[model samples]
Target: MSAETASARLADIQSRIAQATKIAGRRADDVTLIAVSKTHDAAAIQPLIDAGQRVFGENRVQEAAAKWPALKTATHDIRLHLVGQLQSNKAADAVALFDAIHSVDRPSLVAALAKAMAESGKRPDCFIQVNIGNEPQKGGVAVAELPALLAEAQAAGLPIAGLMAVPPFEVDSAPYFALLAKLAREAGLDGLSIGMSDDFEVAVTIGATHVRVGTALFGARA
Candidate 1:
Protein backbone atom coordinates (compact mmCIF):
# COMPACT_ATOMS: atom_id res chain seq x y z
CA MET A 1 0.00 0.00 0.00
CA SER A 2 1.11 3.51 -0.71
CA ALA A 3 1.61 6.07 2.04
CA GLU A 4 -1.42 8.01 0.85
CA THR A 5 -3.57 4.90 0.90
CA ALA A 6 -2.44 4.03 4.38
CA SER A 7 -2.95 7.57 5.62
CA ALA A 8 -6.49 7.67 4.28
CA ARG A 9 -7.31 4.32 5.85
CA LEU A 10 -5.88 5.36 9.19
CA ALA A 11 -7.79 8.64 9.09
CA ASP A 12 -11.07 6.88 8.38
CA ILE A 13 -10.58 4.37 11.17
CA GLN A 14 -9.58 7.12 13.59
CA SER A 15 -12.63 9.14 12.66
CA ARG A 16 -14.89 6.14 13.18
CA ILE A 17 -13.26 5.42 16.51
CA ALA A 18 -13.75 9.03 17.54
CA GLN A 19 -17.39 8.86 16.55
CA ALA A 20 -17.88 5.58 18.41
CA THR A 21 -16.30 6.95 21.55
CA LYS A 22 -18.45 10.02 21.27
CA ILE A 23 -21.60 7.93 20.97
CA ALA A 24 -20.46 5.88 23.96
CA GLY A 25 -19.77 9.04 25.98
CA ARG A 26 -16.13 8.05 26.27
CA ARG A 27 -12.95 9.87 25.34
CA ALA A 28 -11.34 8.66 22.12
CA ASP A 29 -7.91 9.00 23.65
CA ASP A 30 -8.89 6.41 26.21
CA VAL A 31 -9.05 3.85 23.42
CA THR A 32 -5.92 2.55 21.78
CA LEU A 33 -6.20 1.36 18.16
CA ILE A 34 -3.85 -1.51 17.51
CA ALA A 35 -3.59 -2.07 13.77
CA VAL A 36 -3.42 -5.85 13.51
CA SER A 37 -0.48 -6.32 11.20
CA LYS A 38 -0.22 -10.09 11.29
CA THR A 39 0.86 -11.98 8.12
CA HIS A 40 1.67 -8.75 6.32
CA ASP A 41 5.35 -8.42 5.58
CA ALA A 42 7.40 -5.29 6.28
CA ALA A 43 6.74 -3.81 2.86
CA ALA A 44 3.03 -3.84 3.59
CA ILE A 45 3.46 -2.34 7.09
CA GLN A 46 5.76 0.61 6.44
CA PRO A 47 3.14 2.82 4.87
CA LEU A 48 1.04 2.82 8.00
CA ILE A 49 4.12 3.71 10.03
CA ASP A 50 4.81 6.55 7.68
CA ALA A 51 1.25 7.65 8.26
CA GLY A 52 2.00 7.87 12.02
CA GLN A 53 0.45 4.63 13.20
CA ARG A 54 2.66 3.80 16.17
CA VAL A 55 0.76 0.90 17.75
CA PHE A 56 0.44 -2.47 15.95
CA GLY A 57 -0.64 -6.03 16.67
CA GLU A 58 0.95 -9.20 15.34
CA ASN A 59 -0.04 -12.87 15.61
CA ARG A 60 3.20 -14.80 15.96
CA VAL A 61 6.37 -14.06 17.87
CA GLN A 62 8.43 -15.59 15.10
CA GLU A 63 6.81 -13.43 12.40
CA ALA A 64 7.09 -10.30 14.52
CA ALA A 65 10.70 -11.17 15.28
CA ALA A 66 11.33 -11.32 11.55
CA LYS A 67 9.59 -7.97 10.87
CA TRP A 68 9.59 -5.56 13.84
CA PRO A 69 13.22 -5.44 14.91
CA ALA A 70 14.06 -3.59 11.73
CA LEU A 71 10.88 -1.52 11.90
CA LYS A 72 11.42 -0.65 15.55
CA THR A 73 15.02 0.20 14.79
CA ALA A 74 13.87 2.61 12.10
CA THR A 75 11.38 4.26 14.41
CA HIS A 76 11.79 3.71 18.12
CA ASP A 77 8.22 4.57 19.13
CA ILE A 78 6.29 1.66 17.65
CA ARG A 79 4.41 -0.39 20.25
CA LEU A 80 4.05 -4.02 19.27
CA HIS A 81 1.35 -6.28 20.72
CA LEU A 82 0.93 -10.02 20.41
CA VAL A 83 -2.75 -10.61 19.59
CA GLY A 84 -2.88 -14.34 18.84
CA GLN A 85 -2.85 -17.49 20.93
CA LEU A 86 0.55 -17.92 22.52
CA GLN A 87 2.17 -21.20 23.37
CA SER A 88 3.82 -21.71 26.75
CA ASN A 89 7.13 -22.51 25.11
CA LYS A 90 7.09 -19.22 23.21
CA ALA A 91 6.66 -17.22 26.41
CA ALA A 92 10.26 -16.02 26.55
CA ASP A 93 10.25 -14.75 22.97
CA ALA A 94 6.85 -13.13 23.38
CA VAL A 95 7.98 -11.36 26.54
CA ALA A 96 11.09 -10.09 24.83
CA LEU A 97 9.31 -9.02 21.63
CA PHE A 98 5.94 -7.57 22.52
CA ASP A 99 5.15 -4.47 24.52
CA ALA A 100 1.80 -5.99 25.48
CA ILE A 101 0.31 -9.46 25.11
CA HIS A 102 -3.45 -9.92 24.56
CA SER A 103 -3.59 -13.72 24.77
CA VAL A 104 -2.42 -14.75 28.19
CA ASP A 105 -5.09 -17.41 28.78
CA ARG A 106 -3.80 -20.41 30.74
CA PRO A 107 -2.03 -20.99 34.04
CA SER A 108 0.76 -22.90 32.35
CA LEU A 109 1.35 -20.01 29.96
CA VAL A 110 1.15 -17.60 32.86
CA ALA A 111 3.79 -19.58 34.76
CA ALA A 112 5.98 -19.78 31.70
CA LEU A 113 5.71 -16.04 31.03
CA ALA A 114 6.58 -15.25 34.64
CA LYS A 115 9.70 -17.34 34.38
CA ALA A 116 10.51 -15.71 31.05
CA MET A 117 10.10 -12.25 32.50
CA ALA A 118 12.35 -13.13 35.38
CA GLU A 119 15.00 -14.67 33.17
CA SER A 120 14.91 -12.02 30.45
CA GLY A 121 14.48 -9.06 32.78
CA LYS A 122 11.70 -7.89 30.53
CA ARG A 123 8.08 -7.72 31.61
CA PRO A 124 5.25 -7.26 29.11
CA ASP A 125 1.79 -6.22 30.16
CA CYS A 126 -0.65 -9.13 29.78
CA PHE A 127 -4.37 -9.44 29.06
CA ILE A 128 -6.16 -12.56 30.25
CA GLN A 129 -8.22 -13.83 27.33
CA VAL A 130 -11.61 -15.33 28.07
CA ASN A 131 -13.47 -17.63 25.75
CA ILE A 132 -16.51 -15.44 26.13
CA GLY A 133 -18.67 -17.57 23.86
CA ASN A 134 -17.13 -20.78 25.20
CA GLU A 135 -15.81 -21.58 21.74
CA PRO A 136 -13.97 -24.89 21.87
CA GLN A 137 -11.35 -24.04 19.26
CA LYS A 138 -10.43 -20.61 20.60
CA GLY A 139 -7.53 -20.07 22.97
CA GLY A 140 -8.95 -18.49 26.10
CA VAL A 141 -9.60 -19.51 29.65
CA ALA A 142 -13.21 -20.41 30.15
CA VAL A 143 -15.01 -17.43 31.69
CA ALA A 144 -16.04 -19.54 34.67
CA GLU A 145 -12.38 -20.37 35.32
CA LEU A 146 -11.21 -16.76 34.93
CA PRO A 147 -10.96 -15.72 38.56
CA ALA A 148 -8.81 -18.69 39.49
CA LEU A 149 -6.56 -18.17 36.46
CA LEU A 150 -6.29 -14.49 37.34
CA ALA A 151 -5.32 -15.40 40.89
CA GLU A 152 -2.71 -17.73 39.50
CA ALA A 153 -1.34 -15.00 37.23
CA GLN A 154 -1.17 -12.56 40.11
CA ALA A 155 0.54 -15.09 42.33
CA ALA A 156 3.23 -15.52 39.71
CA GLY A 157 3.76 -11.74 39.61
CA LEU A 158 2.48 -11.16 36.07
CA PRO A 159 1.71 -7.59 35.08
CA ILE A 160 -1.94 -7.98 34.28
CA ALA A 161 -3.19 -5.38 31.77
CA GLY A 162 -6.83 -6.43 31.35
CA LEU A 163 -9.04 -8.87 29.42
CA MET A 164 -9.41 -9.86 25.72
CA ALA A 165 -11.79 -12.01 23.70
CA VAL A 166 -13.07 -12.80 20.21
CA PRO A 167 -16.81 -13.25 20.08
CA PRO A 168 -18.21 -15.98 17.84
CA PHE A 169 -17.96 -15.04 14.17
CA GLU A 170 -21.04 -14.19 12.07
CA VAL A 171 -22.96 -13.56 15.26
CA ASP A 172 -23.91 -10.28 16.84
CA SER A 173 -20.80 -9.41 18.90
CA ALA A 174 -22.32 -6.81 21.22
CA PRO A 175 -23.42 -9.20 23.94
CA TYR A 176 -20.08 -10.94 24.08
CA PHE A 177 -18.29 -7.61 24.14
CA ALA A 178 -20.54 -6.50 26.96
CA LEU A 179 -19.84 -9.72 28.81
CA LEU A 180 -16.08 -9.29 28.42
CA ALA A 181 -16.37 -5.73 29.67
CA LYS A 182 -18.35 -6.92 32.66
CA LEU A 183 -15.86 -9.64 33.37
CA ALA A 184 -12.98 -7.17 33.17
CA ARG A 185 -14.74 -4.77 35.51
CA GLU A 186 -15.53 -7.58 37.90
CA ALA A 187 -11.88 -8.54 37.92
CA GLY A 188 -10.97 -4.90 38.62
CA LEU A 189 -9.24 -4.64 35.28
CA ASP A 190 -9.37 -1.28 33.55
CA GLY A 191 -8.26 -2.42 30.11
CA LEU A 192 -10.42 -4.41 27.72
CA SER A 193 -8.90 -5.76 24.50
CA ILE A 194 -11.91 -6.81 22.47
CA GLY A 195 -13.21 -6.03 18.99
CA MET A 196 -11.93 -6.43 15.51
CA SER A 197 -12.66 -4.95 12.06
CA ASP A 198 -16.35 -5.74 11.90
CA ASP A 199 -17.37 -4.87 15.46
CA PHE A 200 -14.81 -2.43 16.90
CA GLU A 201 -17.18 0.49 17.12
CA VAL A 202 -19.59 -1.68 19.05
CA ALA A 203 -16.66 -2.91 21.08
CA VAL A 204 -15.71 0.66 21.93
CA THR A 205 -19.26 1.40 22.97
CA ILE A 206 -19.19 -1.61 25.25
CA GLY A 207 -15.83 -0.67 26.86
CA ALA A 208 -12.93 -1.79 24.76
CA THR A 209 -9.76 0.06 25.59
CA HIS A 210 -7.83 -1.62 22.81
CA VAL A 211 -9.11 -2.71 19.41
CA ARG A 212 -7.26 -5.21 17.22
CA VAL A 213 -8.28 -4.19 13.68
CA GLY A 214 -6.60 -5.84 10.70
CA THR A 215 -8.50 -6.03 7.39
CA ALA A 216 -10.30 -2.74 7.91
CA LEU A 217 -7.02 -0.94 8.04
CA PHE A 218 -4.66 -3.06 5.97
CA GLY A 219 -7.26 -4.31 3.50
CA ALA A 220 -8.12 -7.99 2.84
CA ARG A 221 -5.33 -10.54 2.86
CA ALA A 222 -4.08 -11.41 -0.62
Candidate 2:
Protein backbone atom coordinates (compact mmCIF):
# COMPACT_ATOMS: atom_id res chain seq x y z
CA MET A 1 0.00 0.00 0.00
CA SER A 2 1.09 3.54 -0.72
CA ALA A 3 1.79 5.94 2.13
CA GLU A 4 -1.30 7.88 1.16
CA THR A 5 -3.44 4.71 1.32
CA ALA A 6 -2.05 3.76 4.69
CA SER A 7 -2.54 7.32 5.95
CA ALA A 8 -6.17 7.35 4.93
CA ARG A 9 -6.78 3.95 6.51
CA LEU A 10 -5.21 5.06 9.77
CA ALA A 11 -7.30 8.22 9.80
CA ASP A 12 -10.45 6.13 9.42
CA ILE A 13 -9.40 3.85 12.26
CA GLN A 14 -8.65 6.78 14.54
CA SER A 15 -12.04 8.28 13.73
CA ARG A 16 -13.71 5.00 14.58
CA ILE A 17 -11.85 4.83 17.86
CA ALA A 18 -12.78 8.40 18.72
CA GLN A 19 -16.40 7.67 18.04
CA ALA A 20 -16.27 4.51 20.13
CA THR A 21 -14.67 6.38 22.99
CA LYS A 22 -17.26 9.11 22.83
CA ILE A 23 -20.12 6.64 22.93
CA ALA A 24 -18.58 4.77 25.81
CA GLY A 25 -17.72 7.90 27.80
CA ARG A 26 -14.13 6.75 27.98
CA ARG A 27 -10.99 8.59 26.96
CA ALA A 28 -9.45 7.36 23.71
CA ASP A 29 -6.16 6.98 25.48
CA ASP A 30 -7.69 4.35 27.72
CA VAL A 31 -7.63 1.92 24.82
CA THR A 32 -4.33 1.21 23.12
CA LEU A 33 -4.61 0.41 19.40
CA ILE A 34 -2.18 -2.36 18.48
CA ALA A 35 -1.99 -2.63 14.71
CA VAL A 36 -1.71 -6.29 13.81
CA SER A 37 1.03 -6.32 11.18
CA LYS A 38 1.67 -10.02 10.86
CA THR A 39 1.29 -10.69 7.12
CA HIS A 40 2.20 -7.25 5.78
CA ASP A 41 5.59 -6.35 4.30
CA ALA A 42 8.04 -4.04 6.03
CA ALA A 43 7.35 -1.08 3.74
CA ALA A 44 3.66 -1.30 4.64
CA ILE A 45 4.36 -0.60 8.35
CA GLN A 46 6.47 2.54 7.84
CA PRO A 47 3.44 4.60 6.92
CA LEU A 48 1.69 3.53 10.13
CA ILE A 49 4.74 4.57 12.17
CA ASP A 50 4.76 7.84 10.28
CA ALA A 51 1.13 8.22 11.31
CA GLY A 52 2.30 7.97 14.97
CA GLN A 53 1.52 4.30 15.65
CA ARG A 54 4.24 2.90 17.93
CA VAL A 55 2.81 -0.50 18.86
CA PHE A 56 2.31 -3.38 16.38
CA GLY A 57 1.26 -7.01 16.91
CA GLU A 58 2.66 -10.04 15.09
CA ASN A 59 1.40 -13.65 15.06
CA ARG A 60 4.42 -15.83 14.36
CA VAL A 61 7.96 -15.93 15.75
CA GLN A 62 9.64 -16.49 12.36
CA GLU A 63 7.53 -13.85 10.62
CA ALA A 64 8.31 -11.31 13.36
CA ALA A 65 11.99 -12.27 13.19
CA ALA A 66 11.98 -11.71 9.42
CA LYS A 67 10.44 -8.22 9.70
CA TRP A 68 12.17 -6.96 12.86
CA PRO A 69 15.59 -6.51 11.18
CA ALA A 70 14.13 -4.08 8.63
CA LEU A 71 11.82 -2.36 11.14
CA LYS A 72 14.69 -1.78 13.58
CA THR A 73 16.38 0.64 11.18
CA ALA A 74 13.06 2.17 10.17
CA THR A 75 11.94 3.20 13.65
CA HIS A 76 13.68 3.33 17.01
CA ASP A 77 10.81 3.63 19.52
CA ILE A 78 8.44 1.05 18.08
CA ARG A 79 7.05 -1.66 20.40
CA LEU A 80 6.45 -5.18 19.09
CA HIS A 81 3.84 -7.46 20.71
CA LEU A 82 3.81 -11.17 20.05
CA VAL A 83 0.08 -12.03 19.99
CA GLY A 84 0.28 -15.73 19.28
CA GLN A 85 0.61 -18.95 21.28
CA LEU A 86 4.35 -19.41 21.89
CA GLN A 87 5.70 -22.92 21.68
CA SER A 88 8.16 -23.98 24.39
CA ASN A 89 10.85 -24.57 21.77
CA LYS A 90 10.44 -20.97 20.54
CA ALA A 91 10.50 -19.37 24.01
CA ALA A 92 14.16 -18.37 23.74
CA ASP A 93 13.64 -16.59 20.42
CA ALA A 94 10.49 -14.98 21.81
CA VAL A 95 12.49 -13.69 24.76
CA ALA A 96 14.95 -12.07 22.35
CA LEU A 97 12.23 -10.68 20.06
CA PHE A 98 9.05 -9.21 21.56
CA ASP A 99 8.51 -6.41 24.06
CA ALA A 100 5.50 -8.36 25.37
CA ILE A 101 4.30 -11.94 24.97
CA HIS A 102 0.47 -12.10 25.02
CA SER A 103 -0.25 -15.82 24.76
CA VAL A 104 1.42 -17.56 27.68
CA ASP A 105 -0.80 -20.45 28.92
CA ARG A 106 0.80 -23.44 30.56
CA PRO A 107 3.17 -23.70 33.52
CA SER A 108 5.79 -25.35 31.33
CA LEU A 109 5.81 -22.46 28.84
CA VAL A 110 6.03 -20.00 31.71
CA ALA A 111 9.02 -21.83 33.20
CA ALA A 112 10.72 -22.06 29.82
CA LEU A 113 10.18 -18.35 29.08
CA ALA A 114 11.48 -17.33 32.49
CA LYS A 115 14.60 -19.44 31.99
CA ALA A 116 15.04 -18.15 28.44
CA MET A 117 14.60 -14.53 29.49
CA ALA A 118 17.09 -14.93 32.33
CA GLU A 119 19.66 -16.45 30.00
CA SER A 120 19.15 -13.84 27.25
CA GLY A 121 19.33 -10.92 29.65
CA LYS A 122 15.85 -9.93 28.41
CA ARG A 123 12.80 -9.93 30.62
CA PRO A 124 9.75 -9.39 28.43
CA ASP A 125 6.34 -8.72 30.01
CA CYS A 126 3.86 -11.59 29.74
CA PHE A 127 0.12 -12.39 29.93
CA ILE A 128 -1.71 -15.58 30.82
CA GLN A 129 -3.93 -16.70 27.94
CA VAL A 130 -7.39 -17.67 29.23
CA ASN A 131 -9.56 -20.03 27.19
CA ILE A 132 -12.63 -18.02 28.11
CA GLY A 133 -15.10 -19.77 25.87
CA ASN A 134 -13.46 -23.14 26.50
CA GLU A 135 -13.01 -24.12 22.88
CA PRO A 136 -10.93 -27.24 22.46
CA GLN A 137 -9.05 -25.90 19.41
CA LYS A 138 -8.16 -22.60 21.08
CA GLY A 139 -4.94 -22.34 23.11
CA GLY A 140 -5.47 -20.86 26.61
CA VAL A 141 -5.71 -21.97 30.18
CA ALA A 142 -9.30 -22.55 31.26
CA VAL A 143 -10.69 -19.50 33.03
CA ALA A 144 -11.37 -21.42 36.23
CA GLU A 145 -7.76 -22.57 36.31
CA LEU A 146 -6.22 -19.11 35.94
CA PRO A 147 -5.58 -18.20 39.59
CA ALA A 148 -3.78 -21.46 40.23
CA LEU A 149 -1.71 -21.19 37.08
CA LEU A 150 -0.82 -17.61 37.86
CA ALA A 151 0.15 -18.57 41.40
CA GLU A 152 2.36 -21.32 40.05
CA ALA A 153 4.00 -18.99 37.54
CA GLN A 154 4.57 -16.41 40.23
CA ALA A 155 6.08 -19.07 42.46
CA ALA A 156 8.48 -19.89 39.65
CA GLY A 157 9.43 -16.20 39.48
CA LEU A 158 7.80 -15.74 36.10
CA PRO A 159 7.12 -12.06 35.62
CA ILE A 160 3.47 -12.09 34.61
CA ALA A 161 2.07 -8.74 33.55
CA GLY A 162 -1.61 -9.56 32.72
CA LEU A 163 -4.22 -11.75 30.99
CA MET A 164 -5.34 -12.30 27.35
CA ALA A 165 -8.26 -14.05 25.70
CA VAL A 166 -9.82 -14.75 22.28
CA PRO A 167 -13.62 -15.09 22.52
CA PRO A 168 -15.44 -18.02 21.02
CA PHE A 169 -15.87 -18.26 17.23
CA GLU A 170 -19.69 -18.23 17.09
CA VAL A 171 -20.98 -16.01 19.86
CA ASP A 172 -21.66 -12.39 20.76
CA SER A 173 -18.26 -12.38 22.61
CA ALA A 174 -18.99 -9.08 24.35
CA PRO A 175 -19.93 -10.81 27.58
CA TYR A 176 -16.80 -12.91 27.35
CA PHE A 177 -14.68 -9.81 26.89
CA ALA A 178 -16.40 -8.16 29.83
CA LEU A 179 -15.76 -11.23 31.93
CA LEU A 180 -12.07 -11.17 31.05
CA ALA A 181 -11.87 -7.51 31.97
CA LYS A 182 -13.54 -8.16 35.30
CA LEU A 183 -11.25 -11.09 35.98
CA ALA A 184 -8.19 -9.05 35.10
CA ARG A 185 -9.32 -6.22 37.32
CA GLU A 186 -9.91 -8.57 40.25
CA ALA A 187 -6.45 -10.03 39.70
CA GLY A 188 -4.98 -6.51 39.51
CA LEU A 189 -3.70 -7.11 36.01
CA ASP A 190 -2.33 -4.07 34.24
CA GLY A 191 -2.81 -5.48 30.76
CA LEU A 192 -5.84 -6.89 28.97
CA SER A 193 -5.05 -8.07 25.41
CA ILE A 194 -8.50 -8.56 23.92
CA GLY A 195 -10.43 -7.55 20.79
CA MET A 196 -9.72 -7.79 17.09
CA SER A 197 -10.76 -6.04 13.83
CA ASP A 198 -14.44 -6.99 14.03
CA ASP A 199 -15.31 -6.21 17.67
CA PHE A 200 -12.69 -3.81 18.93
CA GLU A 201 -15.23 -1.09 19.57
CA VAL A 202 -17.18 -3.43 21.83
CA ALA A 203 -13.90 -4.41 23.40
CA VAL A 204 -13.11 -0.76 24.05
CA THR A 205 -16.57 -0.08 25.42
CA ILE A 206 -16.12 -2.92 27.87
CA GLY A 207 -12.64 -1.73 28.89
CA ALA A 208 -9.92 -3.24 26.72
CA THR A 209 -6.51 -1.78 27.36
CA HIS A 210 -5.15 -3.16 24.09
CA VAL A 211 -7.10 -4.02 20.96
CA ARG A 212 -5.38 -5.97 18.16
CA VAL A 213 -6.63 -4.82 14.77
CA GLY A 214 -5.35 -6.48 11.58
CA THR A 215 -7.55 -6.34 8.44
CA ALA A 216 -8.90 -2.91 9.37
CA LEU A 217 -5.36 -1.57 9.20
CA PHE A 218 -3.29 -3.78 6.85
CA GLY A 219 -6.23 -4.92 4.69
CA ALA A 220 -7.10 -8.59 4.04
CA ARG A 221 -4.18 -10.98 4.15
CA ALA A 222 -4.01 -14.03 1.88
**Native RMSD of candidate 2 (Å):** 1.4
Model 1 misplacement above 4 A = none
So what's the TM-score on candidate 2? Answer: 0.94
What residue pairs clash in candidate 2, if any at all?
A: none
The 10 consecutive residues of candidate 2 with the worst lDDT sum are 68-77
Alpha-carbon runs more than 4 Å astray in model 2: none
Model 1 scores what on Cα lDDT?
0.94
Q: State the C-alpha lDDT per candidate.
A: 0.94, 0.87
Q: Clashing pairs in model 1?
A: none
lDDT of 2 by residue, 48-121 (tens): 88887888999999999998867876788888899988899999999898888999899889889888977988
Which is the leading candidate under lDDT?
1
